[model samples]
Target: MGEEMNKDVTIDTPYITLGQLLKEEAVVGTGGQAKWYLREHTVSVNSEPDDRRGRKLYDGDTVQVPEVGTFTIRSK
Candidate 1:
């Protein structure tokens, strides 16, 4: 709804789905909720709103929003 706070999570891989990342990072309250957010919330890649939750998040891809916080794809 407002300016998204910067949040961080460590990813073990380069490619990950939004749904999986949500669960893995415990971002969404529930799996079903993640789906709903995917539809309602405007997820951004680098800065633009990205609706494709199924899109693979690779290196340097940043998912940001007011509720979900900021998730950066990292190497571990």
Candidate 2:
């Protein structure tokens, strides 16, 4: 195998789950509560609180933060 690469994706229609964003992503913390808190606290698109960790992201939405980089939805 080789070093894993995170692909750059854009939303044309929209996706409803954070898990759907990653190929092998996992929540890191003490437990579900902690994970929930992390999800609640962090995770933003275009400087907006992505309340639903399972929110369907739409085009023009930008996922940002200390990590996770930025995900911009492009025309497909």
Highest-TM-score candidate:
1
| TM-score of model number 1 | 0.72
Clashing pairs in 1: none
Report lDDT (Cα) of residue 1, candidate 2.
40
List the candidate 2 regions with Cα displacement exceeding 4 Å: 1-8, 11-16, 23-41
Give the alpha-carbon lDDT of every model: 0.74, 0.50
Lowest-sum lDDT 10-residue window in model 1 = 1-10
lDDT of 1 by residue, 1-76 (tens): 6665665556677688777777777767776777887788777778887766577887777888557478887766
**lDDT per residue (tens digit) for residues 15-46 in model 2:** 53443543223333333443465455576667
